[model samples]
Target: MNAILIYLLKVIAIQAVFYLIYTLIFHKSGRHSINRFYLIFTLAIGFLIPFMSIPKFQSYEPYLEVDKPIWYELSDLAEFSNTEAELIPVERINQSDFTTELIVAGISLISLLFLMKLIYSHFELIRLKRQSKEISKNGHRIYCSQIESPFSYFKSIFIPKSLLDSTSFDTIMEHELVHVKKLHSIDRVLMEVILSIFWFNPLLYLFRNRLIETHEFQADAEVIALQQDPIAYQEILFQQINAQKVISSANYFKLNTIKTRIKMMNKNQKLSKWHYLFILPLMVFLIFSFSSREGEEFVAPLKNDVSDVFDYVVNLSDSYTPSIFPLKDAEGVKLTASFGKRIHPILQVERMHEGIDLKTYKGNPVLATADGIVVEAGIINEISWGKIIRISHNGIFETVYAHLSDIEVKSGDKVKRGDIIGKAGTTGESTGPHLHYEVKELNKGFLNPVDFINDFDFKRYTSIEKKDIIKLGKPNQKLKVVIDPGHGGRDQGIVSSNLSESEIALMVANQVFENFKSSDEVEITLTRDKDELLSLKDRVSKSEGADLFISLHMELHEDEEEEMMTAIYNYQSEHSAASQYFGELLSKEFEEINRKFKVGYTEGNYVLKNAMSPAVLYNIGYFSNSESERYLNSEKGMKEIAQELSDAIMASKY
Candidate 1:
């Protein structure tokens, strides 16, 4: 059974126990003119409480431990030294496994919900018990001032000690006797429990008040049926009104509703039978609908034949010999210098080129090299490379495309192989229109992408660079780091056009956060999980104990004429050596991902200025140029940027 269904069953069980107790207490008193609609409403609300209560297990991630026992071994009695055979070491349960976590989550939430309700009830009972002690004794039972007058039941009613003699304590005692006979206390307690579950529903509060009022009305009518002086009862009620005490189980002495209850008590007319018919069907429909469970079970299926399918396809393709297709316009797209060797566009001087340049015209459609999600979309300014898109493929492989004239998607958009994501353009610091691309493998140093794509014809291209293979790294069990995604809620930092720097910072930070979360050596935390403003000092203060502090932001340019570039800024203090090292590593990685542009590191960002942990402020890319700005707005562009940044961060050494 699903957790929600189990929780619903538990709630039903608790409500059933309460109902049994109520029935047993009130069986002999005979059914009064109680509203059936109220009973149905309460039961319906009780059923919904479980689903409404948020599940606690939704946040757990799977973890694996490899150190202990593996498989179970059978021990033979003949081999054992002791006559009593001993069992061999068996496999231990993996507590961090995802399936195990789901079970734990369900049980934990049920226990927590039950415990919370119990605690709320216990405190309420204690408060009510203390107030009950204040009631004055009248004959064999105690009587108190009844503000929600006309209460039923034999339980002691409390009245102020001063007003005990002035009011007809005998008449009120007779009314209290009716309440005890009618089991009003049990009704009130049950209603209070229902109220607790639907505390957020305002209508439930109204129902509770109405139910209590009805109880008083019924008790008062019974007292009046005995032919006592109604005038004297009214007089008594008026005198004892000020002497009422607060009752936690039922707010019987609610000042606002007391007069109304009294007037209801005095009225002798009965509700029309036609009105009952009108409400009866509606009440029944509500009861069944509210109590009904609508949850569906979720089951994830496994693909056991995946390897077979891949092998079959590979075998079939290898059977036929393919013709060697010659490139028609290869000269137009050929790079003279190999990737990674710096060559100036005009000066012809060797410079460090991080990524391979694919010469293309303006408005040439750029396609995603693989299936991935776009993590970023915007113009890069002084802080980052211009018009960049980052996409995360499977595992640790990521691809970046930069210097685009137009971006066609936004953050969170999904793309497939060969899908046009943007158009090639010379935006940031570019001498001409062309596509700068980089493919990064996890844990592996950058490889020449040109060699990987050389086989493809120039006339037709698959936006994907299949040669940028990711090399999965060995699990590092000892490494530990925390990621703090800056600024949430109201404190949104600088915004340009529709892009908020704070939101972008958090987006990239979260991508890094998730990457670390998936790793064995990393632990992550956010400065603010939801959007809420934090002071610059607080943002820094929260990272005090972390090993690495990465503050994310999109840099803007004071001068509009500047081209796109990626830069890292670190504090200039003595302890910032580590920060500087991290910056250089990241700068090189960024450059490798997009070799056509310059990647540099500077010092002195306020968030990183203080002497503290190794911290780096990554200004992802610049946005001064128009093409870069448009790229920044596209989904593919953003993902490419985020993936590269995350890859760089993950690649950093302690």
Candidate 2:
């Protein structure tokens, strides 16, 4: 609302400035017809612009589902909990305020008009009372009488009985009558009202006065057109000027009126045809500005409240429970038939077929193999799999189903054994529509899902035992370290000469893992055991309570002068001391491999900034140096750098 108000104010200011320019260039210089038109048009624009402006509303929430606490709960506690909090109810305030404001504004406008009318009436009454005191003593005056009406058009200016012989009095009477017929006094009052509304607008006031002067100019022109001796009329204007003092609202026959009126009467110049040219463009611009629709765009209503829909799903899941029962094994289930080698689709190699192939028609319902909660169910546009669903069976064991047609369940939904969760489809890496399933022990690792299903009973499906998946060494005990590879699935981070940073990092991480694995007293866990991308933040977050964090990378230098050197970047505020110690130790270990391996430290790097534990980022080699670049691209060269990285991390004390 504030933004919209500011925009309307700007447009009004621009129009006002243009109006001022018109007044200065044309109206103030000399009398012209176009100037009169400009004056009227400018006043109309000032009155109408505010009414044309509209308000804007552009705020909405996005749809997202995740395991997290509510946002309000996470904000500052004192502010959110206070009873007297000044929270703006946007929806309620917008409707009520706009309607009430419009009503009040309408009433204010009507009251203003009535007040202006009263003020004009009062001033006219005061002028009339003053005029009645003076009487025509000269016999040359035809007639003189002051009537009691503030409106000049209704008031009669009588030619006295004795002043009839004077030709100047007759001419003056005719001129005053013209002013009365035109209602010039009423026009002056209207202009004053306009000036009051646009008090700060100098152009409006200028145009008002100019418009009145033009009215007189037009009336004088009519008098001259009569051909009744212009010099005699000029003299008549002078005699009538002092006969009555100029009323506040009077527009003609006032003090100093003879000087300008006589001068204009003497030099009568008709307006040229070309004088209207300037108005053509001004009219066009006004038509475009006033007639065009330039307000906020309308938005269509949504089918459902998205936030409410999400809440509904969450409530449904909270109330849901999965039913468990025993499963019956098929008769004549040969061991070899159940699990054996099969021809691979892409590799064309005879490898172990780890899972059973569930043959079903297209769109046939596929059920959850066990009582579990849905951990992932969504459409995937990856190169290998299209749509997939993975469920964690009590957080100990899990099953995955790929190449699904449609997923009926979302993450966090609990399911019972044999529940229809999806339909079969040939979504990704398939010869036909079939369900590709896999099961894994929570910590122990992958177990052929088919093996467990054959003897499993839905009612008797007990929780599996948790296994120590990745063994870690005792605290203060010498432990072998493994730096798991990052970005292997389909993402190859930062590549040079077709050699990816992901592949290089993986090679180095694996080599380091192997070097440490040879030590009996040391245990190792690679961040990733296979080619896959692990989120850097997630990995660092879990590395809390870990002995060491070794993030490997191949450096890309834009400057040729920056050569092959191992730089370690760490957060200065959080882990500065630990990072420095780790860097010094790593540098010593790398020195044995090659003297060119130097340690560079940076406190501004993101990975180390929030790390609660000691962390080190190793830039194994530089792309700018041809020799180091070549070595980094090869398996053998990577192994050597990896060996140094492993020895450095293992040598560091927590």
Candidate 3:
């Protein structure tokens, strides 16, 4: 809402500048054609200026102020590697305050009322034309009515019935004819609409009034230019103003600022064509006003009492050379998947595997691959990284460990190579328990994790550069979501005699996919389609660029498992805020199904540990329980579940 106010202020300022230029220079320039065109141009520019800063058309010129990286999403003391300037703590006003909302509502209501009034004004004019007697005279459709003001609208001149036989009516008719021929009503209509839209800006009304004044001056000038008596024209204008009723919809002869019109009549100057060159500076000013990201305040980092851990992590990350296998038994663990180009497990298309997947059983100790500061530690996506942790060795490289059964360290915790950061497990999208590890060079996409560390040597690679971090570009669009349907292929998780976990999961996933596909609001993707083996590495990879991840699964009821629906989210001390919000919503939705939904976090999940989005594993029910199994198998139950889950996902949009 503050953004909206700031934008409106920008538009008002731009239009105000244009208004000043129009009134001070061109309004009285005696060139009606030039003034008319200028007025339209200014109005058009005012409307367009607001849309200029939109992404596709945004200017490439650098903003004087560089926004410091918003590290609030990271640890409490997290320090960015390539931040150009000191981060400023901005104390913005509460956007959700009642006063702010009231102001916004008031603006909307007033703008709407103004628009309705414009519509009514149009209807009123039409009714007047319908009631009047029409007669064509001197190439115009003249409407003879009991209305007081003699005015012109479009190609029609509306004359009062009392003035039909009056001699002075001929002069009024001639003046109205000039307005009709010039199509001055079109300008009035355009200005009126602009006024309605920007009703908050009083200057626009002034701008419109000045434009109308110029229109009358032009019409009067044309009439006098064709006649011999200038004094008679002045007298005729005064006589029209003497009447009471005014024509609000048309260019009426006796309407507004007549003294100024008379002054323009006598003071007509022949401005040179070079005067048009003055528009060059105005154009520049308009572009700068609308497009430039100027006046952004560069805030310095606030001074506060510093902690030793924060200082240690900042200093260590800046200097530490990182390279080590993140898992405890890196040399002994089976190489489940090597990092390189391969056929995508689900998509079938060949894609680069940036990280290596090592098959590790659930609860296996997972170590930090490097000595650095913990940047982000939490659940990223349920279908990608179940419990995840990212460590920044320097601004150049960030290492990610996903699908962990546990996270032992908090964000900002400085750790040396081989420190136990987590335990390996299949917490997210996985066929079984495993560890997915990635080492990424900032802005350079992904680098082979093994390239940075091996059994023989941990620090095999050289230090990364700050310049590489600067090249890290952002995604093109907002709100990309990845949905994963668990247990595909030969592995029919928690299957009974008739019901298959993989099939039920796929059914829900497909329904969710179809719903999302019908709406263009977000870009959506699925980790797997049909029954197939989807690697934990590939599932996490598919979730790249997504803002959220929804992993659908059916949990087999262990002796301790509860017979109810549940949602599992990331549990690190500094977990993803979006992931937390989504998990709560998912919990609420599942509770609506059975009124006994459980929302919680486990030690860690492997797949969601490294996903870039806030993720949740939506456990429909315990497959081991007979009642839950029947609910999963029932067609009506599946349909309702899908609808409820879709509603839960959409709630994040609002």
Best TM-score goes to which candidate? Answer: 3
Order the candidate numbers by TM-score, best to worst: 3, 2, 1
lDDT of each: 0.50, 0.52, 0.66
Summarize candidate 2's per-residue lDDT along 1-654 as a digit string, tens digits. 232333335446646655666655554334544565566666666444432322235422211212222311111110000011111111112223466468557755875875676488657655644554434433322224442211133354444334445655445555566666666666666676655544545555556656766666656766766756787666656655555433445544444445666676777454555655765676556545543231221212223667533432223121111221111122211111123344232222234654444434467677777656675677644335568887755333567777787888987676777787887776754444556666666445566553454323212111110012212245557753436465666877667785887888887776766776677655666777667877767666756666556677665554444444454535244554455456666666766765454433333445555555666666676666676677778777887777776665655532
The number of the candidate with the highest lDDT is 3
Candidate 1 Cα lDDT to native: 0.50
Off by over 4 Å in 1: 1-32, 36-139, 143-154, 250-255, 283-465, 468-654
Model 3 CA lDDT for position 561 = 36
Per-residue lDDT tens digits for candidate 1, residues 1-654, read 233344445455544543443344421122235453345444554554332211122322211111211211101000001001111112234323477558656766765685577567557544644665454454454534323343332264544444456546567666667667777777667666656543534545555555565666666678877846777777666655654434446324323555765676666655444443543464345444333231111111224968533432223111111111111233345331235643233222234455566555687777776555565555744112468776644223456677788888776665665677888777764545667777665336455554334235223211112112221122454333444554556756545566666676666666666666666655666676656777778777766656667766554444354434433334235544455445555655666766323322223445666525666655554455456566666666667766776666566533
**Which parts of model 2 are misplaced by more than 4 Å?**
1-38, 46-170, 241-247, 282-483, 487-503, 506-524, 527-654
For model 3, residues 229-324, the per-residue Cα lDDT tens digits are 788989887887766644455788787677888887788467776787798898777876575231211112223755543543224221244455
Judging by TM-score, tell me the better candidate of 1 and 3.
Answer: 3
TM-score for all predictions? 0.30, 0.39, 0.42
Q: 2 or 3: which has the higher TM-score?
A: 3
Model 3, global lDDT: 0.66
